[model samples]
Target: MRTYSLDDVYATCKRRDSWWTVYFVDPVACRAALLVGNRTNITPNAITVFSLVLGMASAGCLAAGQLAAGAVLFYLSFMVDCVDGKIARLKGTGTPFGLWLDFMGDRIRELCCATGLAYGQYAATGNVDFIVLGVAVVVLDLFRYVNAPQMKRVRDAIREANAARTPPPPGPHEPLPHQSFSHSPVPHQLGALTVRSHPVAAQPSRPPRSRKSRRRLLRRFNKALARRRVRTHLISGIEFHAAVFVIAPLLGQAALIPVTSVISVLFVANEIFLIYRMWLFTRSYSAVPKPEKSREHAPIGGSPNV
Candidate 1:
């Protein structure tokens, strides 16, 4: 077994992670990954299974109305979840099955925990609102997971379509002004005349943009966010889960509804903003000029027959 150092473990972590993970979970998880990587024969899949067990135990505690213990167990489960990925990265022990297990396990854990929290609250207070909130939690989580990947695919498809319509860059072997070719079409071609064998159409130019245009403003905002390593969507699935499972419970039953409601609103708003951005992208993509069909024996230096 190969040994790994602390630095090696840290190196295996993602460059950018959710704020909750980066600030709270990572410091502890990095140490855990290093210890596990060097000292044991444990597989990443085993750690993942262990995380699932912790998660289920957490759900049981929550169901039993042991809110404090449940919160602690839930956080521990998240830490273990972070560890498995780090170990996989450090030891190169990751598998496709491991990835699938991790993803599905997260969904199940959240579902069970949501049900546990809501049921426990309802049992104590006889309120139906908690039960409805539980269903909303599950639905929103599923929607975010389902929609995020499909949205990515749509964006990828749009990018590919745009790329297909764009002209390719010059080949490595293509002659530049500074370089000369051995074989010349013109025997004594010199200076600028050596470059072109055929006449290429001049690219159309667009008018300069106003400083206050929506596109320009968006670009500036994006650049500012990038500089800080911050995403426009501040609250993601990880944050949402943490808020519901950890923060809400720590604050007691009274805070649960308010916390969950706030996070849900933010999550939905971000998703809507993402969809709006995609709409803008599609509009721009549609506006791209398509190549017109050429007429038979068209003049090289003149317009084609109308």
Candidate 2:
């Protein structure tokens, strides 16, 4: 088998990941990935299966009311989960099936863990509220996953529609076309609201430029994050999972309810923030320029041959 350095392993890591994994897990996982990649022929799918087993074991421990053991297993499961992808990227042996399996495995792990924690607590205290919390957590997780992709699709569709309607820039020698902005309204459904889109009125054509100061600020921010290997989304799905499975559990069983409630509220707030951003984005559609009629496409001669 071929060997790779630590730099190679780091290069294969995700550019942006959760702070927990970027700081705590990757330091260990990258070394493990290198060792596995260089010393063994173990495939990424195999590691995914192993991680899934660990996750299942963690769920079993939680269900049995073994909080400390469950916490340890859960963290180990997540760390190993992080490793498989790095190994896949390093080895270049990833497959579509592996991707599908990994996704399905994560979903299964989350579902099992949530149910186990709820059932164990309910069993211990005879309180039904834990069950309710479990169901709500699962629902919120699903909402986050489903909502993100659907919203992204809507944004992509909007951009594509705008691109199709907007005409290309004219050549230097080409004369300017006779132009008039259309006031025709195109109905677009944004979430629950259905509104009409009206392109902006004609204006002086000038080269578009973004503020250099703003660009500089953004560049600096990205560089700072890149140094640590994370992204702007500090409370993404990974963090949510860590809060519920690892952090909350480790904080002791007495703290579970409050911690879970707070994390759930944060998740809902994050989703609402995303929707607000999308609403703001819809405003840009009104700025897409309407296509103008160009004489360049007409026949060269005065009239067509009859």
Candidate 3:
């Protein structure tokens, strides 16, 4: 069997990925894991289980107020988390159980990390506020995790209903004489098509306009900013854990705890808003009357044959 390259593994296993995963973490860690995995009989589920163990160890370290050690273990667990999906894709060994285990592991890790970090902070600072914040973090995170799937199902249902209600495009048998065939080859009556070659035109170049160029740059920047905001709000599991455990601990900044807590609150609010919108959309969709099946099959009232 041929070994999968880092690029191949990444291409096959990448999810709705975050910038940290794409640009920083997975590039190095996942590559190394894939390289090791190719030489070993390690399965993706095995990796996922190992990651969960590591995450638990990380939480233990955090609870013991071993910040640096906890940070290192947390990152190590995340790296393993990245590798499991890649290994699954590479070996074609992904199962529903594996996926469920993976998701469960992520949620457990988040909860453990949140609780551990809060306890560690309280132990270090002797502040009850840390404990409260920690509990809030876990609750918000859990709500986001649990509600997200339900919201997705609602949105999907709405999308499916809308798609069903909309009429499909006319088939070849239907009249569509006005439709353009400029790009496609002309079809023959004998079920074949032939391309008619046309001469290409060279267009004249225009000088760049400073105002228009500035406007274009502004638009691009705004679009990129908007995308970044969305990705930040839709924070991935590893990203959130890494920020609180790894980055904050390394920086010796306990301020990140409150900051991340605030972010979690905002994220919860965003989820609530999304759920409301989805509910509204579903209600509106449900109120619309569907066409009767018999009427669909009936002839037009003004047909000459009728």
**Cα RMSD (Å) per model?**
8.6, 12.8, 10.5
lDDT of 1 by residue, 1-306 (tens): 777888998888786667788778989999999999889989999999999999999999888888888899999999999999999988888999999999988888999999999898889889999999899999999898888898889889888878888867668988665466445564457865555354378998765677448778888987776664556577888899999899989889889899999999998888788889888877877754556767666788777754
- lDDT by residue (1-306, candidate 2, tens digit) is 677999999999887787888887899899888889889998999999999999999999989988778888888888888889998899888999999999999999999999999898899988888899889889998998799999999899889888787788887876555432233257566676655465689997754466767777889998898888887667777878888888888988887888889888887887888898898898767655545545576567654322
Clash list (residue pairs), candidate 3: none
Per-model TM-score on C-alpha atoms: 0.77, 0.78, 0.69
Q: Would you give me the overall lDDT of model 3? A: 0.74
- Model 3: CA > 4 A from native: 13-16, 168-237, 265-287, 290-306
lDDT over C-alpha atoms for residue 113 of model 1: 96
Model-by-model lDDT, in order?
Answer: 0.86, 0.84, 0.74
lDDT of 1 at 219: 89
Which scores better on lDDT, 1 or 3?
A: 1
In model 1, pairs of residues that clash are none
Q: What is the lDDT of residue 273 in candidate 3?
A: 70
In TM-score terms, which candidate is top? 2
Clashes of each: 0, 0, 0
| Candidate 1, poorest ten consecutive residues by summed lDDT | 191-200
